[model samples]
Target: MASRKRPALARLTNALATPSQLQVSQALGLSGSLLSSLHYLGGSLIQVAGAILNIPAPTIATSAIIFHRFHLVAGFLEQSIRDTVAACLYIASKSCEFPLRPSVILAAVDTACQDPLAVGGKRIPKRKYTRANTETLDHWELRILTTLAFNLHVVTPYTLCMEYLVSANVDRDRQKTVAQRAWNYLNDTLKTKICILHQPNVIAVTAIWLAAREAELELLDGEKWWEAFDVDTEDMGHLVLLLREGRDIAIRERDRIESGRKPTLTVEDVKARILEEASLSSRQ
Candidate 1:
C-alpha cells in the first residue's frame, strides 16, 4: 500500500507523468485541471482499469493500458472521478455478462462512438462513425500509454482483492462475477488513494463484505449473490472490520454529497463516525 503520498514512491509518480518522451498533454491538449477533474469526476477510468484485467485472453491490454496512461496525463476532481468509476464498472459488467469478448467491447464502443468500426485500421465494420472518431480513439490510446510509461501490471482493486483472497486461501475463483461485483465497490473508494497508501488489504476486504451485504449475497437475504462461494474466516474478519468502518465513510460521503458539503474523511473523522454507527447499531 505504498501510496503516492509516500516520498519513496515519488519516482513512480514522476514516471507516471512522463507518458513517453512525447508528453501526452502536448499531443492530446490535456490540461492538469482537466486531467485531475476527470479522475475526480470519473470513476469510469478505475472501472475501466478493473474491466481491463478481466478482458479475457487473446485480447490485447492496449485499451486498458492506454486508459491508465491517460490518468497520469489527466487527473479529475472528486465528483466527476466517482461518476467515471461508475461508468467503468458498468462497462466491465457489460463486457463480462456477455462472453468476455474484445469484439463485444469494440461493438459497444462503436455504438457509443457513432463511428464506423475499423478492421485492421481500414475496413469500416460499422457505418455509423467517421474516420475522425476512430482516429481519435486510436490516437488517444497512444498518448495514454505514454503517461503510464508502458507499465501495464499495476495493482487494481479487482486484482488486489483477488490476490488477497488467494493468499488467504479464500476460494471463490470459479465464481468470478460474484467476486468482481464485490471488488468493484471497494475499488470505487480507492479514488481517494487513502487506502492505497495504507491498510489497503483491510479496505479491500471490507468492501467485499459490504458489497455482499448491500447486494444481499450473504447472511439473511443478504447472502444471495455470493452463497455459491466460500470466504475464509480470516478474510471475512478483516473484511468485516474494514466494512464496518467503511459504512461510516460511505454514509458521511453520501450525506455530504447530498447536502452540498465537501467530502473529507480524516482519520479521526472516520473513527468518530464508526463509533457513532456502533452506538446506533447497538441500540437497534
Candidate 2:
C-alpha cells in the first residue's frame, strides 16, 4: 500500500513551490508582509464565499488550495485576486462534484467582496453581474484551468485525518475534543503556505500530533504512532514548527491591526492600486 502511494506523492512534489518560485510575488514588488496579507485575504474570501454558497468544507479547502497554487505559478499581478477566488471556487465546486452555476458563484463572490470597514467606515460597493463581469469571470476561469493544466484533483487531508482519529487509541470522551482541535488546526493551516509545502498525509499527521499532544492523549504506538501511516518523524516535527510559526504570525498581525498600528487594506483598495499601477505601466 505504501509503495503504491509513493508514486502519487512523488507527483505531488511537482506542485510544491521551489525557493525561486516562492520569490515570484516578491519579485513582482509585493513586500513580505503584503504577500502574507494577500494570502490571508484569499483564504478569508474563500471561506466567506463558500459559506454564502453553502459549499462543504472539503470543497472550500480545495478552492483555497487552488488559489494558492495559482498565485504561486502566476503572481498576484497577473490576475485580480478577487476574480481568481471566484474562479477557483467555481472550479473546485465542480471538481468536488458539488457544482454551482456561474451566476450563483458571481453573486456569492460579489457579496463577499464588500468591506464594511472601508475608508470612513463606508461599505464598499458590491460589483454588479453585468455582461462584462461575466466575461471577466470566464476569462479568469480559463486562465486558472490552463495555468493548473486542468489538473484539479485536489487530495485534501480531512478524510485521512478523521480516519487516523478513528484508529487512534484515545478515550471515547476525549476523542471529540482531539478531533475537533485537529480539524481546526487543519483549517488554520489553509491560511498559510503549509498546504502547498507538505503532502496531505503529512499535514494530517501533524495536525493529529499537535491535537493529541495538547490533549495529553497518546496514540496506539505512542512515539512510533506516525510510522504506521508511513510518515517521517522529521517531516512531522518540521510541520508542527511551521504550523506554530504561521499561527504566531497571524496573532501578531491581528494584534497590530487591532492596535491601529497598521491599517487594513480592503479588496477595493488593492484593486484600485493594481489598476493604477497598470495604467502607469501602459503609459510608460
Candidate 3:
C-alpha cells in the first residue's frame, strides 16, 4: 500500500487501537505534529466548555471523554471530531438534570464556529450519533490514527516536577521553591523544541532541573538541594548536565540551518507530494 505522509496520525491510531497512545500521551507529551493536532481537539473542547459556561470539572471531563471517543472513532471533521465534540456536548446537556437536544448541540457548535448551517443546514443529513452510528464511526475513526502513530505523547515537564515534589518529603518553603523553579523551566520549554515531544519522565524532570541549575536558581534556601528529593544524588546531578547538552545541540542545529548545511524540504518535496496525490486520483 502507498504510505500516507502523516506518520504521526498513523502512529496515533495504532497506539489508540492498542491503548498505547494514552501511555505515550501521558509519558512523552506528544510530538510537535501531534500537538498540532491537539489544537483542534483542545479548541473544540474549550468551545463546548465555554458554551456551557463554567461547567463542573467532572462534567467537563465526561464531555471531553465523549468528544475524544468520537474523534477517535470518526477522525476530526464533519461527522468527525467537530461533530463528536458537538454531540458530546449535546449528550452531556441531556444527561445532565437539565435536558438538552441534538438541536441544542448543533446550535452551539454552529454559533461558536460561525458556521451557521451545521445545525440547520438543509443538505446535511441528520443521523443519530449512537450505537446505530457506531459502525460508520469505526470506519472513519482510524483515518488519522495510523498517520499519528510515530508521534505518541508522554509525560510533561509540569508532571515531572510534581512527581519530584511528591517524593521530596519537603516542607512548605521547599515546595514553593520547587514550583517556582519548575515554572521557570516550563516557561523556557515553550520557546524551544524541547516542548515538542515530551521525553521520558526522567528526561522531563532533568530538563527542568537542568534549566534551574543554569539559571542558578537556588532551591530550598540553597542548602537543601541535595536533601530535597530522595533521588539518587548522582542521577540528579545528571539533570544539570542535560541542560548543557540540550543547549549545545540546539546551537549546533541552529548553526547548521543558518548556514544552509541542514537540508531543506524544498520545491521538489512539494512537487513529489503533488504527483503522489495525482497518482492516487488516477488509480481511483
Candidate 4:
C-alpha cells in the first residue's frame, strides 16, 4: 500500500513551482506575488462553490487544480476574460460531482470576484454575468473542454499517497506532519504546470521523496527508496531531478529580486510606476 509514501507525494504536489507557470507570468507580465494571489482567488472561489453546493473539500480542491491547469493552457488573460472564472467553476463543479448548472456557477463566480478584485492594487470590479456574459462563459467552457479533449479525470498524488501511508501504518503524529506538508506542496504545484508534465503516480512518488528530504525524515533504510513504493527507480529519480531544478531556479530568482540588483521591480513597485505613468498621462 506504500502507506509510508503519502507525505512526500502530497508535498511534491504543493511545493514546487513549474516552468509553465513561470512562462505564463512572463507572458502576462505578472510578478510572482500577483500570480500567487490569482491562484488564491481561484482556490477561494472553488471553496465558495463547495460551500454553496455541499461538495466535499477534497473533491473541490482536486477539481480546482485541474481547472487551474486548464486556465494556464487557455492563456491566463486579464479580467476581460470573465469566462475564466465561470468556465473553471463549471468544470470543477462537474468533476467534483457537485454538478452545478452553468448559470449557478456563473453567478457564484461573479459574486466571489466582487468586493476585492484587486490586481496590482487596482480594484478590478467584477462585471455582471448578463446574457452576453453567460454566452461567453458557455463558449469558453466549450473551448476548455475541447482543449482538454473532454478529459475530466484528474488523478493527483494525494489519493495514492494516502493509501500507501495508511497501509504502511506509520505513527499518527508523524503521518499528520508529513501529510500536511505534502498537502501544501500539492496546492502549490497547481499554480505551476507540473501536473500536465508527468503521470500523477510518478509525480506522487517524486513528491514523497522531496517531502522526506525537506523534513529530514529517513523513511527508507537504504539508497533504494523507489523499491519501498514499487516504483521505477529511474523514472522517480528523473522526476526528482526535475523538481530540484525547478526549486533552484525559483530560489535564484527570489534571491535576485530581494537583493534589489535586478532591473525589474516587485509587484508593488510596478503598481506605483504604473500609477505615476497614468497620472502623467492625465496631466498631459
Best candidate, TM-score-wise?
Answer: 2
- lDDT tens digits, residues 1-284, model 1? 11332354333221222325224332344343333223222322332333333443112212232333344445321112222232333333443453333333344443322211111222224435456544544454344445444444333344545654454333364335446766555544443322322233344555566655555544233333232233344544644544354445456556876799754432233234434544554576
lDDT of each: 0.38, 0.75, 0.40, 0.55
Q: What TM-scores do the predictions have?
A: 0.37, 0.81, 0.33, 0.57
Best-first order by TM-score: 2, 4, 1, 3
Candidate that would win on lDDT? 2
> What's the lDDT of the predicted structure labeled candidate 3?
0.40
| lDDT digits (tens) for residues 233-259 of candidate 2 | 888887877667666656765676789
Better of 3 and 4 by TM-score: 4
RMSD of 4: 9.5
Candidate 1: C-alpha lDDT: 0.38
Q: Give the TM-score of candidate 1.
A: 0.37
lDDT, residue 80, model 1: 25
- Cα displacement (angstroms), candidate 2, residue 34, comes to 2.5
lDDT of 4 by residue, 149-233 (tens): 6766556677866765565465788777777776656644543445555556666666666666677776645676656665677
TM-score of 4: 0.57
Candidate 2: where are CA atoms >4 Å away?
1-14, 115-128, 256-265, 269-284
